[model samples]
Target: MPTSVSDRTGYWDRYAEGRSDHQASREEALKGAFGWTQYPGHGPGDEILGHPATTLELGCGRGDAVAALAARGVAATGLDLSPVHYARARERWRDLPCAQFVHGDAMDYLTQTDKEWDAVYSIWGAVWFTDPGELLPRVHDRLAPGGRLVFAHAPAVPGAYGVQGMYGGGFTGRQVWIYRWAYEPDTWSSILADHGFTDIHARVEPAPEPGLLGTLIVQSRKSRPHRMDDLTSSKV
Candidate 1:
């Protein structure tokens, strides 16, 4: 269970160049697997985050979603750590003025930028790849008051914390398998509550197949502002 940075960079750089699979397939699976409706229309019991606002997508792989959202009139910025992906995304969406692709660590970008967005989201992105304790607060800081944060992630198969799957016709190569944290729904709720988020909601849906693991989708709003020291110290 090594958490070295190199383990991620190496696998993702290779993944960026080697991914020949349809980007739309990946997006469709997420939308269907998570049962996502159009922006501002969400799963059952979850509040709509609103749409066509300034949005930031952490780990916006290949920038497909960014392009899609931009086409819908949302000002979207897609950030990723891999230059290989950054370049490809930039090239693919160059003509679309609404979509912007940036190359940098999501956390680093959050820490340095003075910009605040109306919505911040991730789809199986930095929320799992990085430490939640460190990532969540920064996300809170970057969102405007009343802004929403939505992210979706899936756990490994029951009794398993990690797995490896082949991709890109096997001709491109394989990516290194990385271990991801599997937290219960309550744990996610508690984390959001502690960080000054309100209207917190977590939904866990059964897997499509009998043996597969379910997906956890969490959405919360920055109801009000809190001091950094206060958010860091309290554990509720």
Candidate 2:
């Protein structure tokens, strides 16, 4: 039980290029490994986040989704904490002018960047690693009006922290205790409401086995002032 989980870069760094190892082409990797084909922005660029929209992927490992978005004419930036992951992403999409990759802490990047985005998405990325209190507001601030946020998260397994349900594996072979806040379904909705996100929805996709909780596909739109008021009234 390694208690030192403050830094995850080293762990992810060694596993950065694992996506490339599994699938021959980037498109195949995105579909097989990431399930990008089933995401919101998979159709014509304009139908989802809007064509030529500015987008950001938090904890973007190898920048597969970012590269896909850029290919669809979106201005996409992939922020990753692992230098190896960042370098891999940069190299993968170097020729695409619309794609960019940055290596740094996700919260630090969000707090410092002045750029606003039309949409921000993550696929089991930093949203899990970071505290929701610190991460959500920064994300809300960075998204432009009408901006969308979506992420796929697995339901937290039943167990006490550090004792059970801890998952990790890499070259180091050290089993570090995973740090994740396991809250109920409504708790996620409450957090989003508090952060001024409207039209919040969570779809539970069934898990592979019975009796196991499924994945939560959460989606929300940045609420306008009027929408916020409406949400408040509806809650009361």
Candidate 3:
């Protein structure tokens, strides 16, 4: 069955049609502003993201990366689950010819949308879904054969995700994947491998500034059709 955007809209407020008025409602999609601080110099994550890259940001909130990418000559689009957030993104990067803002589920959009991209990425956003694993293959199909997927997720280390113990009170963090069952570094790696993504690479990046949580950036590329080892490391 084709992915339906409403399946997600129905769950989160301001995501469905009726939530239009709620855009001005109290409590924004994100409790705080996005874009705390960007990494300095080229790191391993940027190595895989590529230079002058055409990127699809899965949950591009407020367009920080979008604006930055546009400035760097990277063709980028921002897709998000919040119309409120997307509206802000649209207004912020209105003059950017190469940057587009979209209101939709990342997986559903990737699976059903008419466009294909050179890369797919995300920050700490809507990745905590009930079946986020299914998103990998859809990303695989939408990429340009050797395209890559890079994202920063919540740390998988213990004492994180509010778990009380190792397995931690049946915590298992949270159900970001319906079939995959949990959210962890291993879980993400295995999911990517199962979906035919190779050269998997990941690391936890602590924020340079405060008032934000750290992130784990995972970069993977398509294994077939061609090889671009140097191209994979391109970044602005």
lDDT of 2 at 104: 92
lDDT of 2 by residue, 1-236 (tens): 44236446766776675545523577664553334223433212223343438888888887777877777678889899989888878987798889999999878999999999988877778887777877899999999888988776666554432122345673476764455555555677888899889888766666556675566667788965567778899999
Give the better candidate number (1 or 3) by lDDT: 1
Best by lDDT: 2
Q: For model 1, how does the per-residue alpha-carbon lDDT over 1-236 read when each residue is reduced to its tens digit?
A: 34544456666777777787335454452242322322223443222456638989888778776777776677889999878888878887787789899898888999999999998888777676776777889999999988998887774345544223323224555544553555666777887899888888887755555555566778889886677888888954
| All candidates: TM-score | 0.74, 0.77, 0.65
Q: Can you tell me which runs of candidate 2 are displaced by over 4 Å? A: 1-4, 17-23, 30-52, 158-178, 207-213, 225-236
Instruction: Report the Cα lDDT for residue 6, model 2.
Output: 40
lDDT (C-alpha) at residue 80 in model 2: 92
Checking candidate 1 for backbone clashes, the offending pairs are none
Please, what are the lDDT tens digits per residue for candidate 3 over residues 1-236? 32233334423333333434325422232222233224433234344576536888877766666666665577888888766678777875687787788898776688787777787777655554425556777888888767887776556555343221222113464222121123466666777888899888765666666655566677788876634766677642
Would you list the C-alpha lDDT of every candidate in the order shown?
Answer: 0.71, 0.72, 0.62
Query: Which candidate wins on TM-score?
Result: 2
For candidate 2, give the lDDT of residue 92: 70
